[model samples]
Target: MTVVELEVTKSADELAKTYIVKGILSEKKEDDALHVAIATCAEMDALVTWNFKHLANLRKAELFYSASLEKGYLKKLEIVTPMEVSNYES
Candidate 1:
């Protein structure tokens, strides 16, 4: 159980605003909230969580990946679940 720190940055408020506008809540909202902030700062490798309802679903992951790509945020952003990473033997 490795816990990764999600420090709030200068852009955190703006990130939360964006998610709120999009009507996302709870885990989904939190995941995007953190990712948006990280995207703004370009300071994270992977966002590991177990919240498949939001962050870990393949469909949602792809959408997030594509959105980040379009915004030039993909270089530093990756969203995956703990189980997804753990499943990889290598």
Candidate 2:
């Protein structure tokens, strides 16, 4: 798997920081980790993970879909567990 850093502009960083401070955005480690995956999926094709608690959970999936729609970021992105993708081939 390739790891890439997503660079945000100073203004964007400030906005994100403000969101965190306002309590509208989550600052939990799990949430932050999933956010990174979401960012990757938004910019790339897919995001593979085993983080069921944060990223691969069905409830979180629904939330992600809704959030993407609300943000006008409904793109062709897949967030799946490794087993889910592996099972598809079998």
Candidate 3:
């Protein structure tokens, strides 16, 4: 098993702050932003979340995607639910 640790660096902090200040996410949901930051910082292609109210919604995803681009994160971050990307057989 491979372990990936997410660190809170200066850039990640700034990204998280941007997410909060831009109203993309509430301050109480900072961890959600941090999670996104981690994914963005790692240059991940997608970020799966169960938080529909914030991360998994179309509007919020658009805002976060735009913000990431504006912040120089070139790759588009696909915010989606586990079910959306899952390969579970019924």
Candidate 4:
């Protein structure tokens, strides 16, 4: 895996806010939304996380993807755990 130097960009911030506005994420979970937003804006193919409660589940994935699409992030981002990628099958 290559190092990806990512930051909290303006577009990411706005997208994160959209997640909050849509009630997909709470403000207290701002960090979670920001993480997703950043990866979405960075055009990442996937974002590996162990936080299954918020970031690495199917229900949350649908919500996050919908919110991202609303913000013009057309590409789908896979939010998965390390194990998922390690054992991925296509």
Which residue pairs come into collision in candidate 2?
Answer: none
Off by over 4 Å in 4: 87-90
- Give the candidate number with the greatest lDDT: 4
On the 0 to 100 scale, the lDDT of residue 52 in model 3 is 93
lDDT tens per residue, model 4, 1-90 = 665889999999999999999999899999999999999999999999999999999999999998888778899999999888765545
For candidate 2, the clash count comes to: 0
Give the C-alpha lDDT of model 2.
0.53
For model 3, how many clashes?
0
Give TM per candidate: 0.56, 0.54, 0.85, 0.92
For 1-90, candidate 3 gives per-residue lDDT tens digits of: 233676788998899899999998899999999999888878877787788987899998889889989899988788889888864445
| Model 4: lDDT to the true structure | 0.92
Clashing pairs in 4: none
Per-model clash counts, in order, read 0, 0, 0, 0
RMSD of each: 4.5, 5.1, 2.9, 3.0
From the highest lDDT down, the ranking of the candidates is 4, 3, 1, 2
Best by TM-score: 4
Flag regions of model 1 displaced more than 4 Å: 1-6, 24-32, 65-76, 86-90
lDDT (tens digit, per residue) of candidate 1 on 7-65 = 67656555555544544435446756666556445556667767778666676656555
Candidates 2 and 3, the one with greater TM-score = 3
Which is the better candidate, 2 or 4, if ranked by lDDT? 4
lDDT of 1 at 8: 73
Winner on lDDT between 1 and 2 is 1
Candidate 2 per-residue lDDT over residues 34-83, each given as its tens digit: 45334634465566778776667766556555555554555635668787
lDDT of each: 0.57, 0.53, 0.85, 0.92
